[model samples]
Target: MGYLICILLYIAGIIIYGIVMGKKKVKTSDDFVVAGRQLPFMILIGTLLASWCGGGGITGSASVVYLYGPVVGTLHFAGAPIGMLLLYFISSKVRSSTKITVPEVFAARYGDGASIIAVICIMLAYVGLCATQIKAAGNIISLITGMDANLATVLSAVGILLLTVSGGMISVAYTDAVSALLMVGGFLLAIPLLIGRAGGWSEAMAAIPAERLTGTGGLGVIAILGYMIPTISLLLGDQNMMQRFASAKSAEEAKKSNLGLFAAEITVCVLIILMCTIGIALFPSLDVPSNIIFSLAVNYLPFVLGAIVLVACVAFIVTTADSYLLSAATNVTYDVWGKYLNKNADDKQKIHFMRITILVLTVLAVVLTLFFPTILSLQMTAYTMYGAAITPALLFALFSKKVTKAGGIAGILTGGVVTVVWTMVLNSPYGIASAIVAVPAAVVVILLVSALTGFKGEETYRRLYENSKS
Candidate 1:
């Protein structure tokens, strides 16, 4: 009864916080989509942190770190820091530009058609990753509390859908900031307590598979690079990062925030690493490492501390689910619907479209989780697809003014075809990470195709290619 009360109280608090915070954001679509383009530094950091360090990082990577050890965790969690570092390189330009989305930037550079196509590709790839976050929420509630995973998953989805409908990006960011505060507070308290529970730090280090620490799984250097390449590429072009940059008050703030985000990511990674390591050390016999963080909390910690951790876990998942749903909705509403279906749609219609789209997406994500396998596989598949298909083309387009329209098309088609064909149909088997080969394959195809067809969208093929060089 005590544990149930703690849980209920927390659920109530977070929900109320989201609603109260989101109450002011319904004035316009711009406010909902981009936070009125004036999010302060702290809020931007909170939202970005909350979005990136979701169930995927807390549970998914925690599980990887616990089982596979630091090597995999680096690829999974630390890879995010790498991503933010890459973002800082272009943070100013991206933020200052009037473009609304990553694909919008592509549209600005190349053409509307190119941007629209990029949106289609990226949105499809992000579905699985977003679905898995919802799945993790359900899995944890069921596994730790002995509830029903399906029911919990459904409830979690409904909550996110409602949160999104209430405020869209405004609601999403506010909740993300709140979640971030809760996450840092909960994890900071729980890590030390968890380590102490595990018979101290030394004992925690002594736990886990020996090979998990070494970061090698019989895969040679080629195989290691193969695995990492996808993460590296995706970080370069992810919509989540783009949206955050777009939300910052200024270009300078965006760049500075990312720099701070990089530092914070390093610190947070260490904390999560410690948490996972402690879990592995203490709970060696646990059936599933993913549930180890909160399960350990509720089992050993008092109901009070346990509830904090539970709230933190829930916050982590909610923050991410809302952000992803928001981003995907943005892509569909602004990129697809606004651009193609209803070029003349007003601001009110746009907001309504986004609200309805998020509802549909939340439902779709819930259904996917019900039918899908583990969250880890779903996340990996989604990341791999986006990393290979969209990351490079977008990055090249960012600095390459001379990239011909024909070349852009070639790049997109080649990337999409190779990524889906190899990963989904053929299954990338070689030692090289699919991105390593796939990105280059895309570049070469785009270049050659543009040379032959002179298919530059707006700029001539030769001029675009030359501009890339200059």
Candidate 2:
């Protein structure tokens, strides 16, 4: 009953906040989509941290750390911070652009054809990513409330849709900021308590399999790299990340936010690994590894602390779902419907269309959750699909003057196609991750094709370079 009250109160506060912000701030499409490009440094950093560390980081990473050990799990989770560190160098460039969606950025460089492919690839990946959050949310709720899993999933999807539709980026970003604080504080407080509960750090270490303490955790090097690449690739070109950068008050603020995110992300990553390691010690016989953190919250911690951490986890999942859902909806509203269908959509029309897209996509995500067996599996597949398909081409277009239109199109098509075929058609042949094959394949196609096509002088690259200089 205490857990239920905390969770419900948290949800209600978020919803009410969304409603209040939507009415006051979301007056125009810009306000709805990017918070009118006025996000301060702290909020931007918080949203970036919260959004990225969602179900994938919480439930998914917890599962991995429980199965493997701290060493292997830490390496597996290193991709995001590494990617954020790299992104810091280019975040200024990303923020300087006026585009709202990644597809818009692509369309500027490679034309409408490339944008269309980007839309397809982004939608595929983001919807799957959104589904993972919904699935995680359901799992958390079911574990806490003893509700039916499927019904909980449907309720989770509805809550995310409501929050997203309420104020778009305004509500999402602000809620993300709040969520970030709660998440960090809750986890930080729980760590020492959890460590003490597990009979201190050394005793906890003695409780687990010795092999789990090894560097590889008995998993192959290839598999570890496979797990790492999708996250790095996704972070490098994730539309959600780009949108947060775009939302910053200035290019400098965007760059600074990355630095903050890196620090926070590293802190959270270490905490997750430690907490899950403690979980392994306490619950070695548990059937489902994904439940490690939640189980710890319920069984290990004191009631109030457990409720707080659980609420924080819920906030993470909800914010991530809405952020991705809103980003995917942006692709449809700006790239597809506004660009091709209406071409002259007013602010009201665009916002309306985006809200509708949110509803439609939420339903799609709920259906997608049925296909994947676990949050980690779904998370990797979505990450690989988007990372392989869009990251190489987008990065090349942004950083290289040699990239050609034909090359960009070919790269997007090849990367996306290879990821789909490798994962779905071939069952990830030999259990190798699609990213290992697909990312390199995309990069090669972009270089080889661009070389053949010859430099055509990318106007977008030239423009962005001039902007950076000025």
Candidate 3:
């Protein structure tokens, strides 16, 4: 009950902070969406770390490690570090280009058709991304408090919606910095306590299966690749990450922030894997492995420490949910409605639309929880959808000067269609991830179509690349 109360208070406090920010700092859509493109490097680092390593790392990655083993967990997460490194290069180009959303980047290069397709794909991907965070939050709250999962989902959604709609990026980014500190502190504190309770390293190592200790956990090569590709693709094209770059004060700040984010992500990934395996050692007969972290906090640790860790984990869930919700709403407002539906809409009008869109998207995210059994299950699908559909075109157009507009359109269409059909219709034939098929398909289409159609123009590419220089 103390854990529950502490977490509830934290949630209430952040929501109130968000409301205050909305009234004071978010008068214009620019302030609301990107904080007027002036976020400092330290705040960017915190927001990037906080948003990236949330429920996805804590709940989704932990569940994979518990069920599969360290090998799969390592493979699943290896792409994130690689993706962040790649983003280090990609961020400068994005910041220099001054594109607010990924679709805006697409529109600048590939024209309106590319932008429209990107809007559809972004909405599809982000709604699922947001849904996974919402589900993870509900799972943690339910496990700790013994509340009904459905009620927990509703409550979690409401808090996330409030935080996201309250002040857009301004609220989300500042709160995320605090959440990141709490997350790292919570895990650091729990490590010693958990090890003491588990009877030390050697006993803990012997408690789980020997196969789980191996490099592959007895799994095949294709299975590992399936886990890796989606993660890389998701990081490569994540609009939430892209928007953070756009929010940076300068291109150099955006580039430097990735270094900080890379360090934070690696630390969080290693700690989460350690905690999950330890969870298996402590509770070998646990019926549900996905609840490993929360179960340990409630049942294994002392009261004060457990409450702190619990609140931190809940903060992780809340921060991530709100980030994606705000990103997706930004897509509808700036990319979709602002361009096509309301070309002359003022800042206040766009901000109102963004709030309405956020409310609807939150409802959809909650509804999606009923379909997936776990956060990890939906995470892969959502990640693949964005990585496969959007990343190829977005990256190629941003960096490749000779790339034709036709090629961008072809890549988007092929990648999006292939991922949906393979996952939903074919049900992942041969146990290969949709990313294994979709990413290569998108790349192939981009290359072939561009070669056939020839270059569209070099001046736009030249302008973007020239400004991108540090």
Candidate 4:
């Protein structure tokens, strides 16, 4: 009952924060979608850190490390920080393009067909990511109250939807800032308590299997690549990160935030790895190893400290779910609806459409969560699909001037189609990640098609690209 109260208080607090943030002056679609493009470096860093250190980080990575051992699993969490560091080079470029979403970038560089395809890929990837967060929320709720998992899922979804529907990115950014502080503090305080309760690091290490302690964790090189590459790929072109970059107040702040984000992400990765490693050691025989981190926070720590960590976990899940939902819905509103359905729609109309889209998306995410077998599998599938399908075209379009429209469109189609077929139709082809095949395939098609076309639009695109950089 005490645990339930703590969770309720946290939910109530987010509700209040959402309502307050939503009241901020919002008169334009730009404001709703990108926080009026006025977010400073600090807020940008918070939201970026909060959004990425989410379901995939907490439950999904924890589950992988717990089951397969930390060596291979750490790579899953490590890729994001590495990606952040790499992003430092491009963050200013992304912001300088003055695009609200990756699709906007696509449409600007590649054309409407490419933009539409990018939207499809974003929807496929982000909705699954939103669903993963919902799954983590449900798992957290069920672990604490022993509630029916379905009921918990519905309740968690409603809470997330409520907060998200209120104020798009404006609310998301502010609340995510608060969530970042809570999450970092909660984890910092909880890990030591957990370590102490688990009978110290030495005992915990003894409880873990000898083989699990090795760097390879008994997994093959190919298997580790499967984990590492997709995460790196997703980070390179993640729409949520791109959207946050677009929201920055200036190009310098946009680039600078990556440095802070990299630092925060490194801190989060180490903490999660430690907590999860300790969790697996303490609860080796639990039925659901994925929930080990949450379980340790709830069942092993002191009640007040446990409650803080639980709320922190909730913040992680909710912030991520809402961020992805907003990103995907933004694509639908601007890239699809604003582009095709209502090209002349005003700010008010677009905002209304975005809210309705959020509701619709929440429902879709709920369904996906109910069907997916595990959060880790779903998370990886979503990451690989986006990374393979979209990142190749995105990176090529952003960095290279020689890419032709024909080549760009073909690359988007091939990458997205191949990832879906590889995962859904062919069962991932010898257990390798779809990106291994899809990204290279997309890149090859892009190069071959562009070369055949003699870089048809190179001079024109180069001018536009140079202007964005300036």
Please, what are the lDDT tens digits per residue for candidate 4 over residues 350-447? 98999899999999999998778899889988998888878888888778888888888888888888888998999887778787888789889988
Instruction: Please list the C-alpha lDDT of all candidates, in the order they appear.
Output: 0.74, 0.91, 0.87, 0.85
**Candidate 2 deviant stretches above 4 angstroms:** 463-470
- Tens-place lDDT per residue, model 3, 173-201, is 99999999888888888988898788997
lDDT of 1: 0.74
Residues 1-470, candidate 1: write the lDDT tens digits: 45545655665666666576567556777788888888889888888888777887776667767766777666657577777788889777667566767777667655777787788777777666778788887876776667777997887787667766777677678668777777778778888788788778777777666777786633466655554666667777888888888888887898888887787777778888877777777777777677777777777687778788777787778778888888889999988899889999998899889888888888878777765566765676677777766776777676665567667766887787777777666766764455666777877876686678654444522222332110
Worst 10 residues of 4 by lDDT: 461-470
Kindly provide the TM-score of model 2 when superposed on the true structure, using C-alpha atoms.
0.98
CA deviation > 4 Å runs, candidate 1: 1-14, 20-22, 217-223, 430-433, 447-470
TM-score winner = 2
Question: Given candidate 2, what's the lDDT at residue 442?
Answer: 95
Order the candidate numbers by lDDT, best to worst: 2, 3, 4, 1
lDDT of 3: 0.87
| TM-scores for every predicted model | 0.90, 0.98, 0.97, 0.97
Give the Å shift of residue 192 in candidate 4: 1.6
> Which is better, 1 or 4, measured by lDDT?
4
> Residue 325 CA error for candidate 1 (Å)?
0.7
Poorly placed runs, candidate 3 (over 4 Å): 462-470
* Model 3 pairs whose backbones collide: none
Candidate achieving higher TM-score, 1 or 4: 4
**Error in Å for residue 213 of model 1:** 2.6
